[model samples]
Target: MTRRVSAIYFLPLVLAAGFLCFFLDQKINASAAPAGFENIPGRILGSAGEAVGDTLFLKADAYFHGGETFPNRPPETKEELGREGFVEDERENEKTLPAQPAGDWISRVNHEVRRHGHYHLTKDKQKEMLPFFAAAVKLDPRNVPAILTAAFWLDKSFDRSDAAIEILKQGARDNPEAWEIDAALADIYFYRKKDYARGEFHYADALRKAKSGDLTRFRRIDLTYHLAESLNFEGKRALALEAYREAFSLYDVENQTPLKETIRGKIQSLVVGE
Candidate 1:
């Protein structure tokens, strides 16, 4: 009877020990898993959200450029039209239509169309497009393009600079390493809000991030130029002159002669003024 009692006492302890070991093993296994494995689901959702945003953007663009119609189509041959019994007047009308611009014709046409307001989104369309952008950012806080596009439409189309700033601030928080976010925030602060000091800070931050990251040379030059402009506007001429000279030096003269010259002029102006 004493032996039976001792066996009963040990059963609970045995069960407890087994449970502890199982928990430890699970914990170790989880810790051993690849770091990126934990992030796979988030990345997938982010990509899906980006795709949705891109699709919505394309739809909006198509509606803006005349709904349901392909923007480019090869001209119908005269013989083909003649076979279809085209009247002389119709053929003459077709001939009078301007020839489509060659090479990247679609982009050129879209630009001209928007320039002349031949095809543009209405306020309702703009409003319709905003929700998808918001959804995209919600799914992927680090989606820089979605964030920037959303901010742009909010500020430019809806006249909601405050809303744009709020979204951009959220994006900046979510993507601390994104120089584009800082650059965009700088632009809004400088031009829309006329908060030059804040603009200078963000612009400088953007340049720092850009230099530290793998940003292209052309993009760095643009950022530096804007930074100089912000400094100049804030009456920091000495700093602006330094920035402009740096921007000028960054340019590939063979490919960017005009841009380099423009920066040179700014630097000269600053020097002459001094």
Candidate 2:
């Protein structure tokens, strides 16, 4: 009779244990699902998101630098995709792009790639940096400082002028009013493209806006002089003389001209027969 009673009590206790185990297991699974299920996919998505986010932020910050929100993406790519296939350009584009927090996405991308690339460059690790720098420049073309920095460290960096030109062209499109962009374009045309007329046009375009009354006051020295040089090279002695004269006049205003006398001397040699 005693043995039978022990068995009855022990059976209930065993059943209770099993129930407790089941309850605990269910709770653990519920808690683990969030982190466990999303562990790998979340990381991948996060990385892709960060890459895209940073690129958008950089471009936004570059153009709308007043701490304004980033602009929406351009429509050219949308149209291109539409032409490629049956992908329609609608509000549904957001379906593919993840939502973003507020900020300059392009600038953020520049900072990210620059940070990673700079570190690698310092360690003399070109293999580690070239691909990253290429991607950075490709995505954040307006970030010329980043490109310049990486180019300074890379071997035969001048070879990347094509890359710089591509970015600058985009910058020109986005920031048409910026004289510096015009000047940069001129530099590329003159120095890299060997197209003096186009290059001269860029410098002249910059000069139209360069109200700075001094050579030192101008944004860059090379642009100021090169345009003059191009004039002389293009057989426009009259215009070249005028440019040098204006350059000197600008220097006279600030007492900080860039070798005005040399430029004046050049004018004499060209105009009056040295």
Candidate 3:
């Protein structure tokens, strides 16, 4: 059986959906929003206008400000950034968070709604909130959480898997090195599209592109282990074994002997035709 990875590893779409619900309530029922909530996009736009010549900085800023003002800069894709060897500032590396200003907006809104005892949202309300997330992605192609959470809700909540896949594909192209987007695409292919081969391919790509410094050791192990699972799903037993071995090597157990032994047992099972 395929190991069902915890939703904790998946994008936190429940919290994301809650955030979107708060925003949707504010947009639909103006009284639900703070006094200047409507002006946020405009404020973000005005700030973007001041960042004209610095395309990279603008992209980074747009990522921080919800991307409402700027058009998608095609030439400045993350792939291009990788090609240009654009290293993020050490300060940026220190601030570890999946960057998404619109999602931040949603988070703040959701928190206020919950504080006021008005957090529950209907299905209809969730449906109404979809467009806002889509628009956020349109504004900022690098909005990882916006793309992920929007796609998650669109597919799971709205039965719009095709739309979700399209969003993820675009996100993959835009953020070429983003293993999270690739992993999500792999999952969508396996579960939603039922394309095991494509799923395996993406999982492999995610594993190949993953850098040890960028991703946590456990996350790296998970990626490799899941790649093995994908290969197994595709009936590539040998590749699966190799992946399991890779996963085992990636794990830095130290005092975590139980997990180390568990992975060892997994490797043994694969080797002995389990």
Which candidate number would show the highest lDDT if scored against the true structure? 1
Return the lDDT, model 1, position 265.
90
| Residue range with the least summed lDDT across 10 consecutive positions in model 1 | 86-95
TM-score between model 2 and native: 0.46
Q: What is the TM-score of each candidate against the true structure?
A: 0.58, 0.46, 0.54
Candidate 2, 25-70: lDDT as tens digits: 6776575323333244333344463365355445333322222223
Total backbone clashes of model 3? Answer: 0
* Residue-by-residue lDDT tens digits, candidate 3, 1-274: 7898788965687789889988985675564222245445423454352233134333334443234223321223344334422332222212232232345778867645532210223455456555566556555566677678778878888889899989888878768888788888887888888887888888888877877677887777777777777787788888888988988887665646665676688779878995
Off by over 4 Å in 2: 1-158, 209-222, 253-258
lDDT of 1 by residue, 139-164 (tens): 56666887898899889889899999
What's the CA error at residue 186 for candidate 2, in Å?
A: 2.0
Clashing pairs in 1: none
In angstroms, how far off is 23's CA in candidate 2?
49
Candidate 1 global lDDT: 0.71
Error of 2 at 57 (Å): 10
Pairs in steric clash, model 3: none
